[model samples]
Target: MSNNSILLIDPNFDPANSANLSLLVKIGADTFSYVIIDQERKFVHAVYDEQECEDGYEKLKERLKNDTYLNLKYETVKIATHTQNVVYVPQELFNENEIALYTKFFADADSQNIYVQPSLQQNIYTVFSLPYSIEKIVNHNWQQSIKLEQNAGLLELAVQFDKETLIIDFTVGSFQFVYIKNNNIAFNQNYQFEDTEELTYFILLIVNQLNINMKQVAVNVCGIINDGDNKWSLLTQYFDKVEILTLVSDLDTTILDDMPAHYYTSLLALQTCG
Candidate 1:
């Protein structure tokens, strides 16, 4: 199957679309294309399907003949593409800490590998892709580590008991979620969301259903929708404690504004562990 990915074309080039052209060479992606969506959602430039790849430098130059404005603005066409590729991770390559984190993350899923991500913008931990067998082992061990982290003040302590840790993620369109538990007792549920409004009611429903005090709860927000102050300030109405978390530091600022959040997250994740 063709991989689904997002491409970021050079802001300078109009017709060269050379950025996309170059990616086709490096990744050998099955399909290639570009869509320029303005604030008005108007198409400024575009190419799709078979027309995605370029013939050669000469041909690419010819295509940009009409892109005189871009010619004056930039020297070369640079583009960024987000594509999926089968990634492999040897079990022994990861430590018990990393494996434990993934186990708590995957819970009941069965997958060979896991995607370990740390967000630069939000500086939060994200674990994706895990096999069921490893997940159980990791989760089991994570509970033990969590007890240590909490006692050592590494984890949120206010709601470390029977209550749940409410996660309101505003990172992407569709958020991924998971519940971390301690035996039969469930202590936390991570709620991933593109924006708070989309799942605001659901959060309230859960709070009411669980009969949580909300004030004693901890809320973690990520992405552009919720700012450092707003992430905690607004949630203060419902949560006793609220904090903003990011896996990246100030040095990683460039990538945050330059790339899409998910792409940035994946790249940052790779960079940190590498």
Candidate 2:
């Protein structure tokens, strides 16, 4: 964790009771966030951290070794990671044997681990891949963890709520863009941006091609962008409906007091994965 990372927990939270809490984690090679929620869907503990991609794996190892809350036993564990190599197959058409054909999730087929992510609100199966090392670390740390791609959570929200026609999630060096039309994912991809110019090009290409109504688009921006940041300035200027995404309404978010609610909306939404 860095100086800017944030961790919060209810002072009265009982360590013995963690057996009933559900752990939801959103992770990437470089960034990680997780929440411990009770059966009532209340967030009791949360942590968000980021660093250079090279150090992410080390950070994960350190945190898991030293973080008491994370080491606690949980009734359920759900994890989500961002991957651009995704193939959406209908439930009926999904073939477990053929899933191995999805580009080895961008790795040598033998070195990659594939995951099939299912959604309650959508009929399609989100099949994606992650490095074998990443999956090994996660599964080794927490037994029986359900895995999902980040876009699965974003798409789930779009289908269930019929809102946020487009969502943009920012992280350390990249951002993911999801466009939902008619309650289905139209476009979802992650892009690396070295400067605002590169980001503007991608955003404009999508907006111009879709000819989206800036007024009614329901553009929600979440993750790392801050007020007046280059990404923030570009987005607020591009869409009239652009705004920081709010945390899900189903849980008590007062745990986030004095924190940026928008920064973790995507991580909190992984609750939908469970």
Candidate 3:
């Protein structure tokens, strides 16, 4: 176990059945977390980095190397991240020649580093990027890599709710807001804030801009938030129905008894995507 990382392993994890394992990794600017599960959707092992590392990818790779269980081949691997260079493209307007369209919305698009994920809606797709070196590390370690998703928080939120709803996912120093209306995505964005007030202001701005009825739309929150936290209290004041997001019902939760299920909502949702 790494000094700065926390590991939780299910008592019944079977090393002999490594072939049934699937790994889900969530990499962020300063930290990373991963969960390993068996084919039955039962958690095998999980780890979270408590302190932010300047070289998070390197540190994570080192930890993975040292952990004997993690070295085994898994049935599938999925990686998700939050990157600024992401753009949503409608299938009708997207073409090879228009790859540069991402730059129109996000100024930092590197032509050589782009990746795309087709959405459940045939007409929509998402374009994003992962650092070349990090992508290489993931590829080298897990040859069965399934898909890499950018702004995965929003993607997870989009599929969880089908009606008019507001979803918020919180991380270390930032949070993501996703609004879904009429079984379609209305607005999706990420924001950084230093305190509860800044977060509140941003939410208000989005509500006004989208003309959302705060009273009518339900707000679902997940990630690093707790009921007693200031952000939770503040959100309750503006929205009549604010609730913490819940994990998919089919997943086994015996090993996660000590932690809030909402914290792993995004990782669980990744299993549903490509």
After superposing candidate 3, which stretches have Cα over 4 Å from the reference?
1-5, 40-59, 103-113, 153-157
Task: State the lDDT of candidate 2 residue by residue for 104-192, as single tens digits.
Answer: 55534444566677777555678877657777888887869888886656666666447547888887567878887776666767777
Writing each residue's lDDT as its tens digit, candidate 1 over 130-225 gives 334433543442322110100011122212334355444332333222122331122323333335574666567666776666666555443333
Better of 1 and 3 by TM-score: 3
Give the number of colliding residue pairs in candidate 2.
0
Clashing pairs in 3: none
Better of 2 and 3 by lDDT: 2
lDDT (C-alpha) at residue 110 in model 2: 40
- Name model 1 segments beyond 4 Å from true: 1-164, 176-198, 209-211, 228-234, 248-253, 257-274
Model 3 residue 194 CA deviation in Å:
2.2
| Per-residue error (Å), model 3, residue 271 | 0.7
Q: Give the TM-score of candidate 2.
A: 0.85
lDDT of 3: 0.72
TM-score for each predicted model, relative to the true structure: 0.32, 0.85, 0.85
